[model samples]
Target: MPHINLLPWRELQRKQSQNKFVTILLLVVLVSFLSMYMLSTYYGNLRDGQNIKNSFLTTEIGHLDARIHEIRELDKKKESLQQRMRLIEDLQSSRNLGTQIMDEVAKIVPGGVYLTKLERRGSAIHVIGRSESNNRLSTMLRQVQNSYLLEKPTMQGIIAGEKSSRLLSDFNMEFYVKPFDKIGEAKQ
Candidate 1:
């Protein structure tokens, strides 16, 4: 039989097995690195997608906020317009009230009573005049009480002067002038 070199053969087999183990370890490390890289890339893409959605939502919310502001401004303008309209209607309705009050005053005046000065403050009327006699003044007061456009005619003050040829008796009287039915009643 030929003599076998077992030492060299065993050494060669040990070197081959060590090389195989190193290669398998390097392959496992490479596979782990690749998987980590893929996972990182996927998470980065997902974060980027989420950021984009957030940006879009922010833009849409800005538009909605602007619309809400515009609507509030329009509502304020509408309220102002409504107030102006109400003021205009009130003015229109009371347009003829002054003339009517004057007409009523003329109708209530008795004969022999002449007004020298007339002043109006709100609904009150101040009359400074001369009457032919005290009886005439009483008659004028009675007429004012019975008239349609005068109420609560409280005689505030009365002054009498010496009798004169041109004027019968000097007097001063203050009374109130009432307004029309609906418009005046609502005020009270």
Candidate 2:
């Protein structure tokens, strides 16, 4: 137990412990910083990937929207063409209506009945005529009523008149033209 100065040895031991503690603290701090950087970079990459996917979806959606618009336009055009076709069909069906009416009138008039004027009003025709006898005029009316292109013969007026020293009765009559579909069906 000689006097060797234990205070200096204890002081040196304290300094070494303090240095070791500092080194371990520095190591812990470096490891924490590296981990935080790695985590942040990984999250950033994930965000970038998500953004790319979102952009792709957006572009595809825009393309699909454009296609849908084109489809709508095509549908409208098709509908317009269909309407035009229907109009043409209607015109074609009614094309022979006037001819049919004239032919029917020629067949329906009796020999003693003369038609002076025939005027059309929508689906009805007003006829001005002179007849030799009431019986002849009535026969013409019966024929008109029974015609495939005519219907509903009605007498409007009758007047006794002299035409070129011949006995004639001036008369006014009305009749309806039969529907085109019905006329076609009846002829068939």
Candidate 3:
């Protein structure tokens, strides 16, 4: 064999191998960085879409809540109006109660009895009257009992008096006025 120097060729070969290795490492790093960027962008887009959907749902819920509140307010107002209407109807129906009571009292009065004063408090009527005899007062009480407008006649007091030189009895009595609706039902 000829005496050949192979060190230079061996050194060149080692350098070339190192260059190739460095280039492959750089390519791998670049590929990994690109993949990571793509994955991050995809996740960001998904998060943005979820946020938009959530915002829309929140807005819709707010509108529905407002409508529910309005409906509740309207219901309350309707109830209040209905209550007022009922009160007005009651007042209108009971307007003739005084006349009915007076008519019943006039019909029950006998010839020898005279009403002095009449007082009403709540559902009770206070009747002060003068009668010629106790029998006349008894008859008046019986008439009051049979009347549709009055009931529960109670004698509070009785005193002897002189009217036109004849003895008379002054009396105080209380009677309860029947409710208008009950009176109508009883008549029917």
Candidate 4:
């Protein structure tokens, strides 16, 4: 039999196997590092895109807020103008009140009764007058009660006037003016 060196051959085989394992390990580590870098880049791009969208939305919201503020101001101005218009309309509608009151007084006065002072406060009319006689004052009171515009006639006081040639009576009276809406109903 020829003498063969099997030990050296076995040792060479072992070294080759060790080298192959180290090469595979290094390849695996390199591949893992590349995959990690690629995943991080992808996530960073997504984050940047979301940030841009958020900034756009914020700008749009700011514009909408400005418009809302302007709308509120316009509404306030509109309400103020409406109130002024309503006040003017009310003044115009009540313009004939004084004339109506005077006409009513003229119609209610009796022939023998002369009004000296006529004062109106709110719904109450205060009348100071001189009458030819007590009967004339009583007739005036009855006229006031039957008037469409007057009601609740109250005689405050009556006194004999100065000792003149003719007997005269001074009287103070108060009556409430009926509201225009009720005047027609009262007459009916």
List, in order, the clash count of every candidate structure: 0, 0, 0, 0
Which run of 10 residues does model 4 get worst, by summed lDDT?
Answer: 89-98
Q: 1-188, model 1: which lDDT tens digit per residue? A: 47876999999999999999999999999999999999999999999999999999999999999999999999999999999987887788668778977887788778888889888899888888878787878888888777666766655555666545545767777777665454456455
Rank the models by lDDT, top first. 2, 3, 4, 1
Score each candidate by Cα lDDT: 0.80, 0.91, 0.90, 0.87
Better of 2 and 3 by lDDT: 2
Task: Name the runs in model 2 displaced over 4 angstroms.
Answer: 1-83, 162-166
Better of 2 and 3 by TM-score: 3
- Clashing residue pairs, backbone N/CA/C < 3 A, model 4: none
84-151 in candidate 4: lDDT tens per residue?
98778656745776787899889888888899999999989999988888788888789888887788
Candidate 3: tens digits of C-alpha lDDT, residues 1-188: 58899999999999999999999999999999999999999999999999999999999999999999999999999999999998897788778888877888899888899999998898899999888888888998999898877889999999888666467778999999888677877788
| Winning candidate number (lDDT) | 2
Measured with C-alpha atoms, the lDDT of residue 28 in candidate 3 is 97
Q: What is the lDDT of residue 184 in candidate 3?
A: 73
| lDDT at position 149, candidate 4 | 76
Candidate 4 accuracy as TM-score? 0.56
Winner by TM-score: 4
In model 4, what lDDT does residue 46 have? 97
Model 3 scores a TM of: 0.55
